[model samples]
Target: MAKITLKDLSHSYLKTQSSDADWAVRDVNIDWEDGGAYALLGPSGCGKTTLLNIISGLINPTKGDILFDDKMVSNLNPVERNIAQIFQFPVIYDTMTVYDNLAFPLKNRKIEEDKIKAKVHEIAEMLELSSTLNNRASGLTADGKQKISLGRGLVRSDVNAIMFDEPLTVIDPHLKWILRSKLKELHQKINRTMIYVTHDQTEALTFADQVVVMHEGQIVQTGTPVDLFEKPKHTFVGYFIGSPGMNLLPCEFKGGDVMLNGKKIETHTKVKSNNFSKTEIGVRPEFINFSSEGIPVKVLSVSNTGRHKIVDTQSQSGKIKMIAKTSEDIPSGSAFLSFKKEYTYAYGDDWIIE
Candidate 1:
């Protein structure tokens, strides 16, 4: 495994463009540690796959350099980078058997036959496909075929890094969990550097040790899963990371108090800004709840998600939602809602305080 460094990386699909919209990927500088597991997470057209391709040597960067273990690999081809890339769909031979598909790569690399047999057996058993080793690849299910693709990628232990590009897009929901858990277990056992690219938040959160959240071709934040959830650096991060996401209400920060819809509430801030334009207050629905002496809101709709009830409401300021444990006595009429200051965050123009 190698420590990957992306130094001043940027890309533009348009040749002669002056504005930011012309760029596909912006100036991104991030250092991924050796043997670290990372996920490139964002919505579509957010440059996750572009960054992945640059790292894999399939596309030459329009600007900047890529370093693998301190060696410049920006201009090198995919083979020279010693990277394994797994795509969304499985690529296999219809004529070959399951055992042959798994053994194909090893055989091409001229690995010993006995070693290939042992390794194939190990991967097959781990993937729960040991019984179907002799089955023709064409007869296998879509999920089974994808498992072979994954096994092929993992079979090569000499690669510098293994990159997965939304490899579970075709798999079923139940199997998705099993595969994700298996990948985590495999990473723990091998300790190889892995970079998984996905637009799905759940997949990224579960599979990555550190997640790099990208938007509109630029990386917004890179932190542990808990860090991304507990304290988002950007408001977009706040809104994009969660299910219903974070509630960001436009407000003004006036010293120790935050003003929203002519209502002032005490908020925590170490230092106040003089020209804090577009100031907003953000709090997760989980942190805000119904209380007697607080801002009032009218209940709109309620959803019972087994564990808790999500109370959707309309307030004087705007819409604000809350998560309640039980639906008992929860009024649909006008009621008051309060935000916990400890869990509250003040933002200036959708940017968090330093």
Candidate 2:
């Protein structure tokens, strides 16, 4: 295992990049500790894959260096970097049996036959594919083939790091959860440095110790799942990480107070300066509650989702969403809203006011 470091990383596909739009990845610097499980997360076209490819030596950055431990590997190819990559689709030989497929890498390195057998079986049992060891790779289901891809990466002990690029994309909805759980278990058992790239929040939150959230070719935040949800450093992080997401209301900072629709609002963070071009207050839907006396709002809709209700309300300033208990009475037409001050935050120019 190796500690991966990306120093001032930036990648542009164009020959002559003129603007930020020309860059696929921008000014990324991260230190992935040895044996750490991390997820590169974001929406599509947010540079998640580009950054992953760079780390695995599949692509060299236009302007930066990649290091494994202390050695600079910016110019090394994927093979020289000793990286194992699992793709969205399975990349196993169809003619080979499951055992042979897992043992292919070991065989390529001319490992002893007995050791290869032991290692292949070990990975197969962990992935619950022991029963299908003799089956042809062509006969397995999509999930099964994907498991083989994972096993191939695991069987190799010399890999510097194992990187997954949306490895569960083709998996069925129900099976996705199972595969994700299995991946987490494998990471714990092997204790290898693993980097998973995905656009799904659930995958990132559940499997990774740290989630690197990227937006528009830039990393917005790197934190634990709870940290990302509770204390988002950017408005985009607040808007992207949650189910109903956080409610952003336009506000003005005046005399050490936040004014929203002519009403004084409370927030945990104080504005440092009012020099920003845009200013807003951010509070998660989970932090807002209906109150008898607060900001007046018109209840627009209520979506019942079994245990809880997602209430949509329109205030004078903007739309606000709140999560209410299923048993609680939701007032129709007009009601008042209150934000939990401890969970409320002030923002300027899309970044959190610190």
Candidate 3:
């Protein structure tokens, strides 16, 4: 395993990129600790794949350096970097059996035949593919084929890190959860550095210890699942991480107090900024609840999602959403919404105020 570091890394496909919009990945500096599991998460076209490719040495950056354990390795090829990368689609030998497919990487390094067999069996059991060891790769399902690809990467104990790029896209919903859980289990048993790239928030949150959220070719936040949910550094993270997202209401601030639609709303942070172009109060649906007295709103709609109900309301300021428990009461015409003091955040421009 190795501590992967990206120092002032930036990449662009255009030869003479003139603006920030032209770069596929902007300046990003981060250290991925050895034996740590991380996820690069964002929406489509958010440069998640671009950054993954750069780390795996598949694409050279337009600027900056990549270091593995403090060794500058920006110029190294993928093979020279000693990292394994699994792609969105399965990449395996159709003619080979499942056992041979898993053993290929070990065999390439001329490992002893007995050791190769042991490694293959260990990975196959971990992936629940031991029963199909002798089965031909061409005959397996999409999930099975992908498992082989993952096993190929995991079989190599010498790999500095293992990177997966949306590897579960083609998997069924039920199988996707199973595979994600399996991956998490594998990480714990092997304790190797793993980087997963995906747009699915569930996959990212469940699999990674630290998630790196990206937007518009820049990394917005790197934090645990709870950190992203409770305190989003960027408004995009507040809106992107949750199911109903966060409700950002335009407000005015004066003397460490916030005024929303002429009513004072309490927040945990004291935001004092005079030069911001916009000011807003951000609160998650999970934190907002109905109260007899608070901000007045018209109950626009309510959606029952089994476990919880999502209530949409419109105030003079704008639309706001709140998550309610299944047994929680909901008024018909009009109601007052109350935000938890500690959970509420103040924002200047698009970033949360400290």
Candidate 4:
């Protein structure tokens, strides 16, 4: 396995453009530790796939360099980089048998037939395909085909890194969970550097030890799943990570008081009188308490999702929503909200902190 580094990386489609809009991937510098599992997460067209392709060497960047173990490899081809990539859908030979499909990579490299057979059998067993080793791929189910594709990538231990680009899209919702957990288990057993790309937050959080959040061609944040849920560093990050996301209220900052629509709200952070004229106060749904005191809200809708009830409400300031467990009862009419001081974050414009 190798440590991956991206140095001042920015890629644009045009020949020579300097603006941010022209670039597919904006300036980014990050180091992915050796043998670590990482997931690139973001909405569609946010450059997550582009970044993955760049790292895999399927596409070249317009500028900057990529390094594997401190050696520059931005120009290397996919095969020369020693990277194994699994696509969104299964990429196996339908005409070939499951065993042959898994054996293709090893045979292509002129490895000994006995060794290839042993390795293929081992990977097939790991994928639970040992019983169907001789089964033709054309007759297998989608999930079975995908398993073959996964086995193909994992059959070789000489690969520098294994990359996956939304490899669970075609999978059934229930099977997706099982496959994700299995992938995590496999990662632990093999200890290979793996980078996965996905737009789904649940998939990203469950599979990767670290997640890289991208927005509009730039990486907004990189952190553990818990770090992102509890403390988001950007307004977009706050608006994107959670189920209902976070509540953002524009406020006036002066001294220790946070003025919202001329009313001062209590805060955990110390603020100077003239520090920042205006900023945004962000709090998660879990941090906002629906109490008898504080700002009042009108309940627009309430949805019971088994374990919790997601309450959609509207306040004088703007739209506000909160989640309450099914066991907890919400007070009827003009429900009040109490913000958790310690859990709140202060932001200047869209960026958090100061």
The whole-model C-alpha lDDT of candidate 3 against the native structure comes to: 0.93
Taken over the whole model, the C-alpha lDDT of each candidate is 0.86, 0.92, 0.93, 0.86
> TM-scores across all candidates?
0.91, 0.96, 0.94, 0.92
TM-score of 4: 0.92
Local error of candidate 2 at 225, Å? 0.8
Better of 1 and 4 by TM-score: 4
Cα lDDT of model 4 by residue, 21-68, tens digit: 888899988999988999999999999888988998988988788999
lDDT of 2 by residue, 151-254 (tens): 99999887989999999999999999999999898889889999999988989999999999999999999999999999999999999999999899899999
Span of 10 residues, lowest total lDDT, candidate 2: 268-277
Give every collision pair in model 3: none
- The runs of at least 3 residues in candidate 4 whose Cα sits more than 4 Å from the true structure, single-residue gaps closed, are 255-257, 268-278
lDDT assessment of candidate 1: 0.86
TM-score: which candidate is best? 2
After superposing candidate 3, which stretches have Cα over 4 Å from the reference? none
The weakest ten consecutive residues by lDDT in model 4 span 269-278
Clashes of each: 0, 0, 0, 0
User: Per-residue lDDT of 285-333 in model 1, one digit per residue for the tens?
Assistant: 8888788878888999999898888889998778898888875557879
